[model samples]
Target: MPRLPYLSGVAAATAVVALLAAAPPPSGEVTVSRPRVVAHFDFAQGQTPENIALEPDGSADLTFSAARQIAHVTKQGHTRIRATLPAEANPRTPVVGDDIVLGIARAHDGTLYVTYATGTRKTGVWRVAPGGAPRQIAQLPSNGLPNAIGLDERRGVLYVADSVLGTVWSVPQQGGTPTEWAKDTALDPVPGSEGGFGVGANGLKVHDGAVWVSNSDRGTLLRIPVRRNGSAGPIETRATGLGGIDDFAFTGRGDTVLAAMFLDNELALVRPDGTHTVVLTQEDGLSNPTSVAVRHRTVYVTSGAFFTMRDPNLLLADLGERHDR
Candidate 1:
């Protein structure tokens, strides 16, 4: 028998909650049948919200470089100042490009991991305690430039996508040497184009014993089975032709995945069978989206005016019952 994709429904609610907290609530208040725009925030005007991470409690957290701060946005739209990166962490590291926290991951114990790259000169991982300061975990090897970070809730492994070498490394969440778990070539079939090799792995996640990566250059999503010991199995392609694909998130539904296509200016809803359709397109409110997160049926996205810039926007998308479709 073929592998079955996970589907979201009332029956899966428990699993969804156990897997991912509410993280962020739907931007819209009223419930609808299909996905719709709920709330919008523009960073270009100084509201700088960079990478977003959702908690199981329906709350959202955003990293802001302008104020050198991290904020927690509640389900009710209330924003709180969580903590500020000390000048010493030097979030403004010359090489880190003003955007150190390009990716964020939270473990089941509530430990938060942030990835930073500073101008090919220096780059390291930071682990944020529940109520303590962010401490350096491990420095990226000279050949590695951390672009994306993902957590394996089951094995206590942290997955980092290196843009410099287009490879993925599995590091112990507790901190230690990392191993090459998988590569982007899994999705790229053409010679010199395996999963757009050499283009850098931009986004990644390990779900249900499988690893998924965003090959932004090739506009494809790559998946491969992951071993508990941090080894990787054969690779496979999940979805493709996603113009300017930036990031992806599961809708708590097994077979469903939502992808953010920056260039296309739309959110592509994908099924496990490799079929997808645009469920939400850029309307009057969204502009240059770069990341996505889902809570319940609500989808939260971060938009920016330019890539690798301090300017960004926070746009909420309501998936409602359409998630069932």
Candidate 2:
């Protein structure tokens, strides 16, 4: 939920240099047209869209982080709240942050799953079936900040990213107790984080038979293969040096992906071999983008504006004729 790390100049430069291999060649090396604004938001009203779940009907269901609400954005650029989560009088969520909704995933049956971080016991995974009310399906560790949630339909389970705990948890598709699916130093926050929440494993995805994660604090992307017996396979650091990376979506072009770099206010196309290209920037209406979702030839990005405190909007970029999936 936090953006803009206040790292020292030298350390920041080093981090950027280290990620050069995963970055676009140069500013002019890639030419991405400015994305068109799909819908503007009122940050003061807490309508900052944090995560997205695209539906088959060409609409998107989103989690409004600070608003404690789920909304729907239509193809015509219209939007409305689909579900409103419980508001707290006092939020105790870790890292001195307010109670908020972060990552979200949609099921085939129109069910929506979301990750909520409240300092209280209500902190966990919640599900809403179309028009039904939000129900707690799984109770995760309240000590950590659960940021992203991914549902593996093939495995019939859910994978959660705990940014603070540096762990990935798995819960039954039917909703139950969560078990530790994977944990390692690669998922932990860096040592000298003096700004933001010092988050790790911020974004998550279950694709190509693997659980992919982004470590915001460490600036690394990881992939953990799912074993046949439902166990976590060896961990692989696929990409690195992407500081402030929040959430990403695979372009369906094998391992290619689009990542939202929160601190840099940019979006990057991370290739299969670890190199990347900056496809969009603040000039394209990105203001601390938090998450991305790709559907066919369109790229959907959510600008949370947590740092700028300005326009929190959604931008849509067309990848020309290149199909996403």
Best by lDDT: 2
Can you write out model 1's per-residue Cα lDDT over 108-208, one digit (the tens) per residue? 67777876554333356678888878776777765455756888766778888775566777778888776776765543222232322233466676677
Prediction 2 global C-alpha lDDT: 0.83
Quote model 2's TM-score: 0.90
Please provide, for model 2 over 178-246, each residue's C-alpha lDDT reduced to its tens digit, 9 standing for 90 to 100. Answer: 999999989987655454346888999998989999998888899999999999999999998688899
- Regions more than 4 Å wrong, model 2: 2-34, 192-197, 321-325
**Model 2 residue 159 distance off true place after TM-score fit, in angstroms:** 0.6
Clashes of each: 15, 2
Instruction: Give the runs in model 1 whose Cα sits over 4 Å from its true position.
Output: 1-50, 65-69, 84-99, 120-122, 184-199, 307-311, 322-325
